[model samples]
Target: MSRDITAVFRPDPSSPNNNTFTNITPNSGYCQPIPANCNESGRRFSSFRLPIIFRSTAAIQAGHVDPRQGAMYQVPASWRAVQVANARTGETATLEIRWAGMGSQYNLYTSAVELVGGGVTPHVAHQRLWGGSEWINAPAPCRDGRLGHFNNTIYTFFWHTSAEGTCAKRASYQIPDLYFPFLDFGYELRTPDPLMMSSGQYTGSLTYTVGPGQDVDMGDVLLPNDSAITLHFNLDVDHTLKVDVPPGGNRVELAPQEGWQAWLNSGQKPTRLFRDQRFHISASSRFKMALECQAISGDTCAIFDAGTGHAVSVDVSVSLPNGITDPAGQPVSRRRLLRDGSGTELFQAGSFVDRGMGTLHFEVGRERLAEMLDNGGNRYTGNVTVIWDSEV
Candidate 1:
């Protein structure tokens, strides 16, 4: 089966703070570095202006197989190739496939993988197969760089453009040896750990094991025309998924108060089936919360207090969704934790404070406050004022 994949950004859908993923264009300072072309170009160029070319869908076929057996029939696997049409040259450049379909620990069906192109091996001269016999050298950073074939059916390749600065070529079909299969495979398996909190915070951790899938862990930025990778995820059972809140703090809660049932059942475990693949799986918890706050005073300090109101104390307590426990698994005493009381002024003032007079105080002993902090200190202190009138 064929599917479409898209890129995700850092400052995502929820908060509007940082938008590194938005307004991305050629030479926008955030584009990935130029790829190291190993063929005969003898130059370094960054292809940052390649558009994504994707096949509409993939076609999976099967031979005479018994339905009761529940086995996948062999299919003619091909690279569902996509291209990044260079805007400058109006030419459709060939993009290399990096991570093929996801991989599995099982050796079943050989994983349907392959890699076919020029200079796929190391120490070999670049053989331009696309435009002409332009000799390019092997990629400079050739540690993990090279043409890769998985299970011998899925073909994938990765290369860097050699230009002076970060820019795309004005010609289409610029990169030689650029042909990718239509699809690879996709499968996803997830295990959820519900982290219960005593302070009414909804939270959980999902342990995912993707088999027969590709691993895509390049630098912070993704290279242009980098082939997409995919995985199939089958959930064993659908359970109530929700994010925890910070005590009484106002945050979007994701709890199924009523009829919130999972799509999958308990007996039926989710299984990931691989196929013609080029996709990515990004799993993040929607049930997680982050705190943001500013430090009113220049005191970057973290002070601990036992439920006791003493100036300082030394005690450890592990808190859960329902209760708190000491190192010996016994119930520990409760207390408030305050970093710098000066920062709480703005929140408690319920309004704007002028530069000099208002002071902020944060308390943690209260049950609600402790519960909010338990949801992962999503709320952090921030500094809104650079130059204050008076010091705390």
Candidate 2:
């Protein structure tokens, strides 16, 4: 049987408003999310109860699960990698998952029900292994078979170290063909950056062999019903890309710096004419920019003089917020916009930038200024369309 793991990432209105995935899968009815571990480690975890069971035809000596103590484990406690692909876009990303912790509604059956309540205390069993420090831990009955009724649980926490990890216990008495009916497991996932990933569902699976010297080793004493168990992963990302402008922001008026008072009074020649129109943007994905001008020039847009039949090219550029950057990871500042969409094809955000201020620059050089000034009564006007596309 294969377990299902689901995670989703979206812009949250909570503290540390990061673009990190949230584990939507509930615990296998065993382990829960611990605030200290999750906060310190920057990783998301979820739980699942696998249908695989460990049945013992023969008795297991006390120390097989752990070389040192009498420990029992259900997971391999090692890293495994899988490649997830978006079904629609054919885009692929690598996902790494490992057994972070484990537990179960174990059926650690006793030979008789009369011996179910007076075994080792939970603290005594807890002290046998290297645990009691993770999400959940329930010690199995050790001394008395009656102990199984109190806390017939076998929980363990895993570590990323090379030494590997196992929980502890030891039986001073016999458990009579000890059988564990199901496996409850916790998994930690490492995924690619959601900002760079396209919005969609990505799917993949990984199966592990569960037996002696296998991925989910239970030693020679225990045998699992399913030789291999698969875990199916589903990663969903919901992103946001929005642009907003103010009431008077639509109509742009480009004029020489300090206005035309000097040119009108003393006939002073103006060096250049420009205007900076501000806008707000909130983004959580990578985007590209392009332009569609009503009056097209060689490299930029042009404003046409209706009366004099004169047209002047106005240079257009953009300045994005601090977090958003170019393909080369440099802050965008007055980067020229073109009809070809070059250089602005891959703007990425470092985080979820909410309502960040950006600017669109419109300018005419001194060379182009002479033509417009020559016609004193002429007014140049043209429509410039700026396109922000997330298709890239």
Candidate 3:
């Protein structure tokens, strides 16, 4: 969207008849001759003018031009706020604002043209007007100005000097001395949360002001204007899931007992497998998790006596604490290792919740180790596979 704030320069009201005001029409074309009325010798004044052009960075990159052609150059405008809806909550999501284009500098100048001049005389003074606390003369060629940030918004104003010199040797000039006629800026929004954001339309607005520099405000002669720019954002959520276990590995060792009674009297205990298991999941909608386990080798869990050629199959069960839960305070029930079937659900949450980090506690138990010893057990090793699944 583009907004035009035209500036009219006229003689001060105290001396209204001293010099006639001339209105310069802003457009996309090259420089034109100054109005004949601006040639009076008396001190003339110019009112500040600012035209703001707002557009998305994408549109600017695509070379979208303003239909009005108010400014010679076209640039993208920065955003004030970008909102996204959390996938789980379907409401406004947390975000961080990042601005771009502040401190970017651009040159303001009039079109260069050759004027009729005798071989011994210069046609027009080579000069440029620059922006400062007030308008000031700059080295010929062009003047530089930068976009500034304040109160969460970007602002800039322009200064103007009427064209000067004889008709036969007229100088091309910028009506509003220094302005951001073709300035472009933009920003990006980001979040660290794991919850995905919904894909949809979002809207916002930014307010800014334009006026003369500090030195140019002669007793309110140069008034400022406040304007609002609307903003829009379309967000999309990405489904993500991750699970990790300790690096060293989950292992348990059992020593053979002298007899069944001795093994029973020893009071064998289940060893804790992994210190902690971690999982992160995000989805555009609702999600659930399940866990399953199976013996790595043959159908039965067993250990063999190499010398006696005998094997003892043992039942291994995994125990978990029923109190495990997610960041959102949703509980995950205790689950037992399953050799078959669909497995057990760990936890489930609706679209309104976001689960950050999840932890799992596991205990490996050897049932009836003494009974296995009676069958002539030897040193044995086996593997179990644990699977974690997430569905959206």
Candidate 4:
């Protein structure tokens, strides 16, 4: 929904005529040639004679929609707000507000309507913020990303190749100025609220179908504080699966197992399903796979596939903490590793274990090396996860 608010203010008593107390004549001998004065009539106090003007200083707080049962999903919506300072010298000015867009509507006396009617309109007039409905032609607030708003601040978290960021999402909001024309009158907008209504759908589900039900062992992983990860699954069949991660669910965090260094051998292509990061295996600790699935299904099937459908490439992502270095000493970073399904080159053919995710074995003997001549190089810290597209 979109709307525009217009605030209008006109001066009440705007005349300095009838000079009974002062020695001034009625528009004759006040100054030299009145016409030539360049300040006559309308020109002679045009500001005082004019009506008080006000530009609408309005904003939309965000509102949220639940998306559990709808086909049309709601991407987090956005809106713009503008406030016009009171141009007149009084506080009884009325502002005309209008909006245009999909499913658009508004309330003139917002406080009155909300208090008496009990609706979406905010209880207070100051809370009538703006919100977005359509997604096209909106303002671009990033160098190479789509703009998004949360908590009244505009931010961009979209991924772009050239930007100086990782696969991780980031946000920022601009603060608005406070003091304004309302102060001239004894009453002013003292408590301008900054909270936005949550308009985006916080809940949604993705659906996928597995042909004839192969051994379905995949389950959701609840991470500590992280939000991204890659799951390494050993599949005997090309099964179509859907993995849904709720927005409110615990974020995924991959931590290295205790005493990780002792078990890592040089010649042991000791491949692990999970890693602490995208950097070399040595720089991070690893973990054992803890899948919550049985080997066989009641359908008596040991293998699973999307019902004889050819394996297709599904897109996925992995994120890691900063400051990881490559074996060649290059800075390591997180990125998406694209792959085609059930391919042996990326997976072990007969073993059903997909190793296509490029490996990150470490050669770091026990001594930690320094990256710079300064103090010894920073120790590798933080976690990493691999991400891949999965069937619902």
Candidate 5:
């Protein structure tokens, strides 16, 4: 059987602390990753649920699938790798996941079954590894993690394991044929950084056999209704590329860096006319930037004087915040933005940048400034649009 599993990630402004994906996949029972249960495996492991149930090959009236005697399992606990490709870009990333904990519901054949340490009718307790002090409360069969919420038809138990080997737990009574109508599980995922991945759905599939001497092994007697299960994963990323321009910030006037003071005081000729337009940006995805200009000179945007018919090349460059980087993984510092979209194809984020300050430099160079100065008493004006697109 094939099942779908999904997770989503988007930049959160208020909670702009770390980068992580939230699992939106539905689960059976309370089979999520609990803090106490994941302490041993560190913070890298998570969990999910599977819709699967095991049935007995033959019905046993009153017996237990004892650990030392019969019950054996080899869960898909070790890391399994899969390649996920973006739905748009065709770029692939590796996604690794493993089963950390497995829980199930064992249905009761009859209501009068006896539990080892459970006195109540619907017994709920941790599975004992052996008969002595080797029970729950000590080092459990989950050698690397701990047990979480437990539930079955008659007896409720939880289990976790990190080591790559077979793990077994006996039934106080028969672990009912109708167990795991839905299996609660925990898993550790080694996913590619969302910052490095393109903005789209990255999809992949992982399938495991469910039988004796297989991935979800239930040993010799207890058989599963399904022979195999395919878990189809869809990890979607919704990127944020918001640019907030200050009020009246659209009109840019360029007239030398230190203003026209040098020319006004000593009759000195200014080298360049420039203005730094500041903007605040919040971005969490790969984006490309380009300029759309009303007037263009060569490959750069230009400002034109309608009366004098004089057009001067206005060079535009950008400087992003600390967390943003250019295509070469260097911090974006005065990177040139051309009309042809050359040096700004893919500006990536090293971290989530929320309302980070950036600069747009508009400059009339020495040559261009000289032409504008030569044609005196003329106002230069033109519209320039800077486009930041997230569909890169």
Candidate 6:
């Protein structure tokens, strides 16, 4: 019974220790056993921090990501310089996202991508997820009230991820050209009238926006900041002219032969012949009318002597209404006479503004008839001709 017994658990100095141990330290004043790395663990507990990173893909030649500002992105001029030549329908320009750290750890959280401010229209926007072998269509997200609108459109795409490791997502934004309706003179350019006049050179502009859906400080990614493009074109018009003579009052009736003979024998003056006429004209340019004479006998008015065969000359005069103008607005003379075979100008128009309906009063008179009767009472006849001319 003799010696006091002591119990202790200790590892042998040469033996390999495999058992686990815990420090059963008391909260108040009692001596406690500390672990080997206690100070290191305490320091780490006070200074622990997690990193978050968002970045553009290596394939992106022109755009950059700002990790400090909520991963905001921009494409400067150098990036914009990369041109898309005649981008086709269904063709797309990709904006990719590469993320690591805590930001990429959302197992069920949803993120959205959007486009705004560009002339592009009727385009398709969607997201793709990385499958083991290929990209697969991800479930598109419904519209979220938080995103609001962009470029007057609510175009948005939502995506979800379940993996917590590094993830890469992409938005394929279809680049489709925009078109506008154009009209001239109430007619489309496709079926324009051939006779329509030209409106000359024309210039116009179109505005557009293209960017992410969120209303952030970042500008449009695919277009200029101004978002306005100029349109230049010219309207071509053709020149045209139309001329017509109205009927029903266009004929002139000369005095009867007996009446003229009685007047010649009695020394009474012959009655002058008169006619009222109208001409309809439509033109886009200047125009005119020329007159000439064709003599069947010796002159426009000549009597052939049956016995001596001597020709007797008679004078004829033609007159039109004074103050009358042609479609071109030029004044037409009231009187003109046939001289030689070359025709003389009877009417003229100077401007397109002056073209339209016109009227003319014609009067024909004969002189030196008594001289024709004295040369042996022979009959004579001639013809008068008129021509209309225009710039086209």
> Please, what is the whole-model Cα lDDT of each candidate in the order they appear?
0.22, 0.69, 0.30, 0.20, 0.71, 0.28
> What tens digits encode model 1's per-residue C-alpha lDDT throughout 1-392?
21222222332224322212221112211113322332223422222222322221212112213221111111111222334332333433222222211111111122221112333432121221211211121222222223333332223333332211111111112221222222222211112221111111121121222111212221111121344323221111111222222343332222222222331344322121111111111111112111223322223322222342222111111112212122343432222112332322211111111111111222223343333334433433222221211111
Return whichever of 1 and 3 wins on lDDT.
Answer: 3
CA deviation > 4 Å runs, candidate 3: 1-181, 186-192, 195-261, 264-290, 295-383, 388-392
TM-score of 5: 0.80
Model 2, 263-350: lDDT tens per residue?
8899999999899999999888899998999999986789988887789999999999988999889999999999899878889988
Q: What does candidate 3's lDDT look like per residue over 1-392, in tens digits?
A: 33222222222324322221132323221111222222225422221122342222111111213322121221122223434454454567443333221122222232212111213212121221111121122211213222122211122322122221110111133322222333222222343232322233222333333322221111112132323333333333333333444454355444432323544687643322223344443322223433333323233344445666554443333332232334455554443344442234333332322234444443323444444455565654445455444432
Ranking by lDDT: 5, 2, 3, 6, 1, 4
Residues 1-392, model 4: lDDT tens digits: 11111111111123211111111212211122232322323422100011111111232112322111110111111221223222221112111111111110112222322322345433221223322221121222212222222222111112112111111111011112111111000000111111110111111111111111111101111011212111111101112111233453223332234433533553322222122222211111111111111223221111122333221111223332232222233432333332222221111011111111223221211211111112322232222223232211
Give model 6's TM-score versus the native structure: 0.32
Candidate 5 lDDT tens digits, 265-357:
997889998999999999887889999999988778888889978888888999999888988789998889888899899998777899999
Clashing pairs in 3: 78-185, 88-351, 158-178, 159-176, 159-177, 159-178, 160-176, 160-177
Q: 1-392, model 6: which lDDT tens digit per residue?
A: 01111111122223212111111212110001222211222321000011211222222211234222122222111111111111222221111111100111111112212232233232222221111111122222211111112222222211222222212332232222211111000000111221221212112221112233321112222221322212222222233456666664334333443456766688765554344455665544333454444433343444344555655343443333333354444454443433442233424322332234555444434544445545564444444444555421
In terms of TM-score, how similar is model 1 to the real structure?
Answer: 0.18
**Ten contiguous residues minimizing lDDT sum, candidate 5:** 129-138
Candidates 5 and 6 compared: the better one by TM-score is: 5
| Clash tally for model 1 | 95
Off by over 4 Å in 4: 1-184, 190-192, 195-392
Instruction: Judging by TM-score against the true structure, name the best candidate.
Output: 5
Evaluated against the true structure, the overall lDDT of model 3 is 0.30
Considering lDDT, which of the candidate structures 4 and 6 is the better prediction for this target? Answer: 6
lDDT of 5: 0.71
Worst 10 residues of 3 by lDDT: 162-171
Residue 71 in candidate 5, Cα distance off native in Å: 2.0
Worst 10 residues of 1 by lDDT: 347-356
Score every model by TM-score.
0.18, 0.78, 0.31, 0.13, 0.80, 0.32
Best by lDDT: 5
